[model samples]
Target: MEKKVIGRRERITLPEWGLKMVTAKVDTGAYTSSIHCTYTEEREVDGVMTLFYRVLSPDNKKYKDKIIATSNYTQKKVKNSFGQAEVRYKVSTKVIMFEEEFDAEFTLTDRSKMRNAILIGRKMIQGKFLVDVAEVNLSLKSKK
Candidate 1:
């Protein structure tokens, strides 16, 4: 089991959502991975409680006007960078990192103000990846 060396920033994809080649900032301080959602709402689908959300803003080049919903989700309160506690929706989806794919949980929230839409937290890369502060897109070059 060799660990993959990832940089501070890496290219990630969500095949289930048809979102690819997106940039994500790697952060060791956070515990749960989060993705930028342009819109989110709590709704009922066929009597099942579900969350309706959309990723990648319409302004983004890769934006394909996608809307995703999940009954398999939960709500959690997390402290943001400014120490403000906010409630966010957590959902599960398949994530592609460094050529490897796996099911990952992501907290959905409005990240329109952030430079990068995706933030890869500590839990997402804990044992599988090693991050180099001075590097970016190391995995991109390898197509991994």
Candidate 2:
């Protein structure tokens, strides 16, 4: 089946994560997309650090309905906007937008204070889109 294309900036829904109508910034400069999370806890389950946390939006609303995840490994020394490095947990999941699905990495961090909850980076959108900076929500608005 052919995949539906998306733009640089679009509103997406994470049905499995119970996140609806969240805006994401499509950044080609970044390799992985990061999501805003809080109350992160790492517990050993079957010799693996099972991650559980709550994702928060800029409005301080918690997506408490969907607050569970597990990953194979955790990456240390990840660089932040200030060029300083910090450890972060990477979780793999399927992101659905515009009727298209793709495997994407979601790095957990507290971005509740930031403007956006998700950053749809290049890795998730590689070969799947053509970003037009002047445009926003092309997929959502087109349906209307």
Q: Give the root-mean-square deviation of each candidate in angstroms.
A: 1.4, 2.6
lDDT of 1 by residue, 1-144 (tens): 899999999998889888887899998898999998888888887899988889877787656578887899999899987799999999988988878998888998888889888999998898899989999998788763
* Best of the candidates, lDDT: 1
Candidate 2 lDDT score relative to the true structure: 0.74
User: 50-103, model 2: which lDDT tens digit per residue?
Assistant: 887777653454655556766554664567656788888887776778766667
**Alpha-carbon error at 82 in model 2, in Å?**
1.6
Worst 10 residues of 2 by lDDT: 57-66
Question: Model 2, residue 23: what's the lDDT?
Answer: 88
Model 1's number of clashes is 2
Q: On a 0 to 1 TM-score scale, where does candidate 1 land against the true structure?
A: 0.94
Q: What stretches of model 1 exceed 4 Å from their correct place?
A: none
Clashes (backbone N, CA, C under 3 Å), per candidate, total: 2, 0
